[model samples]
Target: MFMNIYPKAYISSLSDVKADYFKEKGIKGLILDLDNTIIPWKAAILQPEMADLLKGYQASGLNLCVVSNAFNRRVVGLLEPLGIPGVAWARKPRRKSFLKAMDILGTTPAETAVVGDQLFTDIWGGNRLGLYTVLVIPISKKEFFGTRFVRLLEKFVLNRLAKKGVIEIPE
Candidate 1:
């Protein structure tokens, strides 16, 4: 069960994420999942509110970076103008890419938080690496074929945790 596996998991929405939350939580860096967490999957354009949210984090002295499994240049290119460096092909659920992002941010796992929409990849990877893990509802329910399959598994895990009262679903 995800609860037995990772006891400190949290589920939230991108809009609900506030700079003060991170500050109060003592997070100095953030490893953000680009695809549905920051923008809709396969969408090249960033929403204005999303951009403002990222800016808010930056303004609060928090280091932020996109850590995505996306390998396409087009997908990676979209984030360049945001003025933050990113690590594409992150291969999440694997620790190497998370470590690389941490190295780039010049922070340790203790001082970092990983925010993403997927439970298996993002949350698992972050928790395994000892970073605070936050799971956000995907911006869009539509997903790629492979991602849809992973989401099925993620839902199973979430359900199990919820039944055990270890994971609370956000309102």
Candidate 2:
């Protein structure tokens, strides 16, 4: 039960995940969360460094798709410049949206990874499908009220997982 919510790996930031690392892991595609995972919750656009990093990932032949719970307009607007497809208003941790993302990328679960900051949404969804999961630190302290609530539960689970030697937490 706890393993379902634990990420396969934890990194300080999205930038910590290198393109070669993804390739080395046989990751052919990425299902990414927009808020916090990609950009700060309140950020209107992708940062310059993030854009470059994403471009590098793309150049390495990895397909990318954004799966965000935000409205269509917001998700589309941000991802358009990056040329990445997105499914907005995706109620995550649900298999439908994740399966749809894999379909969009034309990749199987084993060939893709779900990357995000939230455990319930990203890690649970990915692990449920047997897709690799990568957890990143939230970009900023600011976030939605509901996400703030989930973070509390996530903290407890993370602590337990760390104590059990199931996952590593950065110091």
Candidate maximizing TM-score:
2
Candidate 2 clashes between residue pairs 3 or more apart in a chain or in different chains: none
Q: What residue runs in model 2 are displaced by over 4 Å at the alpha carbon?
A: 1-3, 168-171
Weakest ten-residue segment in model 1 by summed lDDT: 1-10
Error of 1 at 139 (Å): 0.9
For residues 38-89, could you state the per-residue lDDT of candidate 2 as single tens digits? 9998589999999998999999899999999889999999999989999998
Model 2: lowest-lDDT 10 consecutive positions: 162-171
| Maximum-lDDT candidate | 2
C-alpha lDDT of candidate 2 relative to the true structure: 0.88
The residue-by-residue lDDT of candidate 1 on 10-89, one tens digit each, is 55566776777777778899999988899988787898898888988899899988889898585568777788878888
Report per-prediction Cα RMSD to one decimal. 2.7, 2.2
